[model samples]
Target: MSSIASQSRSGPRRGRPRDPKTRRRILAAASALLNEGGIGAVTMEAIAERAGVGKPTVYRQWPNAPAVAMAAFLESTRPLAPAARGGRVLEALRIHLRKVAETFATRAGRNTALMIAAAQNDSELAKVFRNHFIMKSREIGRTLLDRAIASRQLRSDLDIEAALDLLYAPLYFRLLIGHGPLDAHFTDAIIDAALGGLKRRRRT
Candidate 1:
């Protein structure tokens, strides 16, 4: 769940051995702090206190606050199931978007927003975030688009990256700008709008 890129260090590592429960608590605590106060508020000592674990416990898993926040952000986005193949493309898309919408409304979601912001200046962190979170989401979208194209239901010439942009870019846009609701209906509407153009035109 830790998404922060690891750093090479030249000394004995300090921290307790990893435990799943402890790790979950720490992530949950990190998420709460992140949601309540943004990234600036998540200190190592604060996470330790919130998670009810020693500072060493947190250090064992994450070297810094960004690391903790990244891990929590990954956990938040991790629950979404990829769009199922062989299902109707639109419905599958709707479900995928719905899960994304639900997660986007949370603190973990907000932490992810922070991750995006942090990555703007931190190239190393940007690489890690793209490799794990963004890459996985893109892969999922790619698979679904491939199936859609093969089914003759969508245009064969569809641009994979652009298609995904149509599906996801708007959601992230709304999340950042707060111009509209990220609700279930909004997800459905976006899917409908994208498919309207993505679908193959009927021949007369």
Candidate 2:
């Protein structure tokens, strides 16, 4: 090896090095506690203990319980599979909605429930939740919808905003209102009804 090659191999590396799975374990620990007992249960000390890491480790990643909960909540609801190009939009929509349903039905659901209630009274948390969760989720849905519209799979003139609301609002409604089930059958119904309206009409 040349002198320059040796020097290139030895220069200081950038950013915090990935610890393989330590950080994931910490986030997992944080999420576990948050899911099981809500925000009150997710302390830095408890997270460190559960993750089998030092307090400094947990603190190094997240400053507070809310921060951890926010990260975990976002992670739990992250898009499962974004629709591929030239793929079936309806199936992709169903897959994404199914994950939403699953998350709302799980322990992380506990954290979401508290966030919803607290958001009503706590302005700051509400803003954080809206920015991180609501906005991000919609962006995901919009990507799928945009692809369909671009490919002429759906009508070009459709109202994307109202269409998005119709696609996702019902799931949240079921979660908060307890009016009905958020099952696969329900998911199918949502997919069909929403797509039915968006589909481009065939010329006679």
Candidate 3:
């Protein structure tokens, strides 16, 4: 018999079972609140009311409002896969940027911006944002950079930290400035300009 069958026959299941549906409902309620009134709108009481659960339930799951907001933000803005792999690092970077642009163009984008502003004043929120969001983006960039280095597509001497900044700083600038909408063409340009220097080749 399968392990599941064996466990069933042995006795009742053990350990704390996770209710995925309940979690999804909570996240959905949080998202709706954020969409309606930004981060400030996502109170434990509000989420409980929206999700048809008690305030204690929301509090039990997440310690604070920022924690819940961070969870909701992550749920809404889960990063997409690299555009291409195995070859064409530049192409992959471009695709990734385009996806980011699209994400920032929606209601989630506004909430993200507000959350960032709030995080500026809240150290705990700042930590959550860095750990949950910024670090993930850095990890993806680092992986791509590592692959490029191994392939001799980019210079081994390049600083991965600085390289990540060069690639992402412009995107943040554009978003914060409201300069223009993030688009394929804009991302393509950023990739082209950045790869020109980072790429392992002599310009002549």
Candidate 4:
């Protein structure tokens, strides 16, 4: 023949040896490990063992424990999307509050608090947490406020930034401080108080 029978594979396949299911398992394992044992416990060795993957696999995916932990944490604590129905801003706000309250009342919340404390010491972790959680919350709240404005439910002249802070800061404080339960009634009361002061009054 043409001396072309000696073709050989050059490198590893373009895809990883493991499939998506294995990757998901690794992420899930990392999340559970962090939740149960905090960031300190998310070593590559431990994550590999927990995930039933090799250490090389973990390292190949994440450069460091913080990166893996961040990914896992974000995966575990993913927030629900804001509802899309029209004319239900207040109701949506209430639902959001209740959901956040429930989150604050869970073991996952405790783990998140620990992550916050850890972030105080780790700048990278802090950046990751802010980007994944804090900024996302701000975006969601801003969208809600913008929608309300577009619908004329809120005053056209209302300062949306200030309004979002006023409406959400109290709830965040409540969540962090454990000052009170974040129930629907509490959310309704907060919405009522905020709307009374923020909404445009009708012409006489």
Top-down TM-score ranking = 1, 3, 4, 2
User: Which residue pairs overlap in candidate 2's backbone?
Assistant: none
- lDDT (10s digit) by residue, model 1, range 7-123: 211211554445677777888998888888887788999999999988876776666777777767766666455646666865676787787778777766756776667658766
lDDT tens per residue, model 4, 57-129: 7665665665666666566666675685868875676676566556655665656656666557666556666
**Model 3, span 73-147: residue lDDT tens:** 766776755855568875676677777777766786757766777567666665655665666776777887888
Arranged by lDDT with the best first, the candidates are: 1, 3, 2, 4
In angstroms, what RMSD does candidate 3 have relative to the true structure? 7.6
Better of 2 and 4 by lDDT: 2
* C-alpha TM-scores of all predictions: 0.81, 0.71, 0.80, 0.74
Clashing pairs in 4: none
Would you give me the overall lDDT of model 4?
0.67
Best of the two (1, 4) by lDDT: 1
Off by over 4 Å in 2: 1-25, 52-63, 83-86, 119-121, 202-204
Positional deviation of residue 48's Cα in model 2 after best superposition, in angstroms: 3.9
Candidate number achieving the greatest TM-score relative to the actual structure: 1
Q: Compare candidates 1 and 4 on TM-score and give the better one.
A: 1
Better of 2 and 3 by lDDT: 3
Tens-digit lDDT track of model 2 for 1-204: 222212122221344543637767876888888867787788888888998988766555555556666666665565555556457875676777777777777767646666667657555555655665666777888888888898788899989999889988888778777677767778778889888788999899
Q: Cα deviation in Å at residue 41, candidate 2?
A: 2.7
